[model samples]
Target: MPNYSEKPTIIFDMDGTLLDLAYDDFIWNELLPIRYAEQHQCSLEQSKQTLFSFYQQHNHTLKWYSSRFWTSQVGVDVLAMQIEQKAKVAKREGCIELLTYLKENGYPIWLATNADYAGLQFKLEETGLRDFFDVIVSSETLGHAKEFIEFWQILASKHPFDAKNCYFIDDTEKVLNGAKLFGIEQLYSIQQPSSAKAPRETCNYPMLSALTDLIPILEAQTTEQAEEQKKYA
Candidate 1:
């Protein structure tokens, strides 16, 4: 069972959580490397290694801001071009419906992601899902990934939802652990097709294989809340 004392504000993660982001894997692993190799006169394997090394070394750096990775590696304006390219390759699944249901029922849905704005915008536009969120927050805006407990505190100060009455759903176990550390009442680790096994400390809360599974519970909760509000009125 989901462990919330009452209906709480829902925070969602984008990318591989609410949206299937296999497109990114394909781009990074295949398309980007091939393009770089073709443009730079290097072996495809060497091109892949170069880009992977940069990402591995600077995964959290704001180097993405300058689009240097694209310039230095692929010799093209990847930030702009990747928008349409990723859309062509991306796919939406059941989670899209769940997000729509949550919005229709008036849940205060906030999106928390570690993605850069351009990347986040691409995914949302590709999936035609920009309107599902009340606000889409990137850790870039927060100045850190959600893995930092401090980032959650900053979010609480700005958003002011109850920690004991909040539902944080994310596919990354590292971010989930950060939520748990900050005393979020319910932490859910989603199982996307691309996600790996639950990392350590995942036993602290429930596991959901798909966002669709939460639809019934949320619908019931919404109905109950409406009925209670009517009675009080």
Candidate 2:
């Protein structure tokens, strides 16, 4: 029942929405801890536990996504690790097709993410998805993570899209909840963010197994609009 012909603003979360989240999981859960262990001469398990605890303290805040902050605290180059793992970066199933469809239909596409600029750049370059976005907003630039209401307020001040006429897709429930709080009417969650992992338990919001699944509805809406326009003309 969604109407793409309304030319609604479409906001996509970078990781887990358009791109497979396995790269990020490996980086945070595996790679970063490994590097942290080596840097501090600690056991891997102990390093992971310590790093996770440290991260949780800043979770859902700007510092959660800030590479500079993490670098200063952890004494490891987060950007370097992201670049080294660039080979693992990949588009999610139907990501390109969905983006291409939206682009061709003239729907405004925005990439809004909690990723820092460095992390966003790494993924963009690796996946070659930069050209698909009209604007890319990062938590680092906004000084607030997507989970914060202030982030959406600032985003509206800058981009000025109608929340009710927008479609937002993200993997994180917290971010979706934030958008909902900001009055966005259409919110979707990705069922499976990491291809390597099984689908997570159902969430409160509607779930998308693949973005292309919405293509038919979008196409139908566009066709209906065209026909109505023709009749009026």
Candidate 3:
């Protein structure tokens, strides 16, 4: 396949990268299963175990829990109400600057998240970041988590972006590995103090302490490529 160099695509993982939902410390650990337990009349411990098992065993399965499941399990219309209330409280720092820099540089930004469509859309909208991205790719759209390399492959096939010049920013090591396997040339791992304890398969990649740290590297690469192209021409 011929490489197109007109524009570089920078893909972002929504939850930990752009908005901080504090899933590990709060939602999964507290809010979610507790809510389910309360509504289902089960013990909190049981709900927690069930939630973990569901995600672990059905990582790629769409049947794990959609809004409907949560509704039935929690006896409330979770889909009708915004689920990102917690996200609003926990969104990470430096996201605005990162999005602005990328937007200014003409990078076609996109989001690939494991969030269900409604939840994903709600978070972006709640954060007021909906307009910054060209597209939002969800695992729900692919019937699997981004942990699988094929999810990214399918996304790339559908969106048809430049992999050689493409970049992926994510907090999950598995998703980063998947991006590498999918042929993304540039990748960044967000490092946040609150997220330091999250489980990662390997911490071998370059760690970014802040989102703004990416600007110089990407700008320098763009400049270097432009100079090299001019010399060739």
Candidate 4:
């Protein structure tokens, strides 16, 4: 077994990193347009164009991640919609396996998500993944989205984690860039955030093809660190 303390805190983004993002895509992309058309008594295309315009304006802001904000803006109860389709919420491939490995190995685990507190609670409840994490945070509580360095600063201020000694895995490049700007050294991106979407061939940071891919990287890191410590000793 590798040295447990040498393992970096594994920080994860909830929607795409641990949980499948296809469900979210369906809710926002497919179902939402239909709902908006029904509500506004407009053509489906017009509803889609209007909602898409709103989406662009708030893409990475705190409002974009909030069900309440979306509900008010779109006149659709997004939280209720999610609850109605709760059965579709699912873990990504190898999510539990990798989480179990880290939990058993005593690596600190955290979930830092742009999801709101209400959304986070229900998803955690639906997946029963709450116990595996040492810390779970929502940007709703922090008052900043993951796309900004302020989110990282506020997160560190509250949780007191070492920026250089932790790894952050997110599906969004802008969010990963935010972590990098905040001095986090180890960062990863999801190659396929939504199974419905094509896998990314390239990213600025290393991309995880599956959750289990992280384990080998951690193990190799342990070997390299041990050799470095031995050389210095």
- Per-model TM against the reference: 0.78, 0.91, 0.82, 0.96
**Which lDDT value does model 3 have at 177?**
83
Please say which candidate is ahead in lDDT: 1 or 2. 2
**Over 4 Å off, model 3:** 1-5, 23-25, 60-65, 69-90, 193-202
lDDT of 1 at 129: 74
lDDT of 2 by residue, 182-225 (tens): 99978999999999899988899988988887677666766887
Q: By lDDT, who's the top model here?
A: 4
lDDT of 3 by residue, 1-233 (tens): 23235667888888777766465346556677767788779998898898787668754445543666656655656665446444433556788898988898788989888878877766766678888999888888887678777888788778888788788888877778878888886888877625536534446678777778888888788788777777667
Please provide, for model 1 over 1-233, each residue's C-alpha lDDT reduced to its tens digit, 9 standing for 90 to 100.
Answer: 33333556889887667766566666667777887788889998898888888777766444543343556655856676566476454433677678777777667788898877767776777677778777778777777678878889988888788887678888777778888889986777765535332323444457676678877766676677777677656
Superior candidate under lDDT, 3 versus 4: 4
Candidate 3 whole-model C-alpha lDDT, 0 to 1: 0.73
Which of the two candidates, 1 or 4, achieves a greater lDDT against the reference? 4
- Candidate 2 global CA lDDT score: 0.88
Single out the weakest 10-residue window by summed lDDT for candidate 4. Answer: 1-10
Instruction: For each candidate in the order shown, give its overall lDDT on alpha carbons.
Output: 0.71, 0.88, 0.73, 0.93
**Candidate 4 per-residue lDDT over residues 40-152, each given as its tens digit:** 99999999999899999999999999999999988999999999999999999999999999999889999999999999999999999999999999999999898999999
**Residue 61, model 3: Cα distance from true site in angstroms:** 4.7
